[model samples]
Target: MKPNDLSTSSFIGWTCKLLAILIIVSLVVDCSSKKDVYYCPMHPHYTSDRPGNCPICNMDLVKKEDTSEHKDHSNASNSLQAAESISNEDHSSHLSETSSEKNSRELILSFEKQQSIGIKTELVSKRNLVKKISAYSSVAYDPELYSALSEYKEAVRSSEFLSPEIIRNLQLRLRQLGLSLDQIRIWTSGARDPSELILGGKSGRAHIYSQIYESDFTTVKVGLPIKFKTDVYPEKEFIGKIKSIDVILDKNNRTLRLRSEVSDPSQLLKPQMFGDTVIQVSLPNVLSVPTSAILDTGKQKIAYVQTAPDKFQAVSVQTGKNIEPWVEVLSGVQENQRVVTESTFLIDSEAKIRFGSDSHAH
Candidate 1:
């Protein structure tokens, strides 16, 4: 053969070999791309290139469908099965926890769903739960009460002339005038004059009367410090300690009368002058959560605690005093745990739908 013919033959063979190698490489690449992918049944987002257990839920990963249409159908079926299994598992766990836990139900929400529902969380922590009681107050002035006291004192002095029934009626009149036995006893005993009790005496002090709700009757004690501000002295704060609390609650308005002797050296407070009173009662070093986080179902109190990202568990808690914006968590929750604050009702509705109505029943 000619030398040019031999070189042409060698080049043609090399070209054919290169084409065959390229075809084989293409086939291998295509086959690798077509290999089955595995994903966690419980956590579909967790996938593996090969068969293995899901790192997240520890469930075996199942083969994922390749086609879009088939994948959607398969995912729906798998989700239903996973939900059923999870419900069964949770039911067993809940039964076992009945002895220790008051009530429990686990719930999972996707990030997108959580964003759509505007869920918010807050950390459970130990803090001073300060309860602030606000009430309407006014400088005290009772002419009728003063007259009644004078009559009672006169009756006491003239007991020899007055009958027993008349003196007892006089004392009953003082009690009806909203004086406790202690106050009537003190004034009649001449410990302090009735005028000093009603009006500012030589001590330059004034009497202030505040009406607090029946709900705060236990919180407002005799010696609790109170602060008041009148429109006339908006910038200034008047201070006092509760001197007395009415033994009887006002039946009509459900309020208890609190009498506090305010330091009025300037005598800025006048009779019937209206102001706002605030009584702050501090509860120290208690485990607390946001008030919004608690769901009081009459019989039981439930709080949702975030155990993982987008996951929450319903916890039955014993609540103490409701310090607005926060509440005392006496049990069933720990400090530093995150609790669902906003959209808690929405999550609870979802939990009911998923875990059945009795999921949180005690």
Candidate 2:
């Protein structure tokens, strides 16, 4: 073969090989550009070149179709419409829940039903509530008290021989027996016998002893008018003024001792005679509501207020002193507001039925 012909054959073979390699490279680049893109159905923004679960919602990733530009625009518009529809549906559901919750807080009663339930209301107002504290009483002839007073007197007389601590201890004993500091000072300073204070003195003034519960300690005062009626003299009423109240309460019975001086001119009153005593306590200018309006749930005090015509709402209240038929309102209802003074428990039951127990949790 000639040398030129051989060289031409080799050149032709190299050109064919180069054209094949160029075609193969173009095919690989086109296939890579057309690869499928995957995206999460629940979280559309999360996309990947391969199929897998979405990191956000753990939903399967779906393949995105490769379509014409116009088809892509159409799909985008459809997705937007679907998203808006879902948003509107969620907003409507929220509105429905809010309306349902609002309706649960109130209870309605018809006029006929109100009458049947004996429902009544009263205005919250400031008033002077008078409380009558009644307690058992007896004509004073305390032998233990007399002995303590006598020891104190004897100690004072022998002051030269008795240590100061001994005398002070005797005075403390008198105090423990229910004598106030002023009463002790008076008895110790005077030469008169202690019997004059316990029994009827020459002036026909007899001591009356009564006890009040610790619950009434705040309402009682030194000069409150007290009336005593004894079984011995059932027809007569003995009048007196509170002279002193014990500084300490009795630990066992939770009561405070009260001493009063009553006029017994007829000398009919005798020691240890059983009687009943009434003390008048006046609480002035305090905000209060009717006792029936308060429903004590043991854990909380609740009052029902008429918020609208035939509609009632439960409100929590803090209460103070209770003077029968009237109770002090520390908080919850405003003055002049109307509260259900009757059928409060029924209203509370209705509220619990309508709104569950949390309706009046405040």
Instruction: State the lDDT of candidate 2 residue by residue for 1-362, as single tens digits.
Output: 99999999999999999999999999988777777789998889999999999999889999997777659888899999999999999999999898776655767888888888889998999998789999888888888888888888888999999999999898888777767788788767874467865665435666888999999998898889999999888899888899888888899999999988777888778888889999988889989998999988888888988888798878889999989889999999999999998888777877788778776765
| 135-173: candidate 1 lDDT, tens digit per residue | 999888777777899999999999999899998998888
What's the TM-score of every candidate structure? Answer: 0.60, 0.75
The deviation in Å at residue 51 for candidate 1 is: 70
Cα-based RMSD of candidate 1: 23.9
Alpha-carbon error at 165 in model 2, in Å?
2.8
Which pairs of residues collide in model 1? none
Write down the lDDT of every candidate, Cα atoms only. 0.85, 0.85
Off by over 4 Å in 1: 1-104, 109-125, 158-182, 189-191, 196-202, 296-300, 307-311, 330-338, 356-359
Kindly report which residue pairs in candidate 2 clash with one another.
none
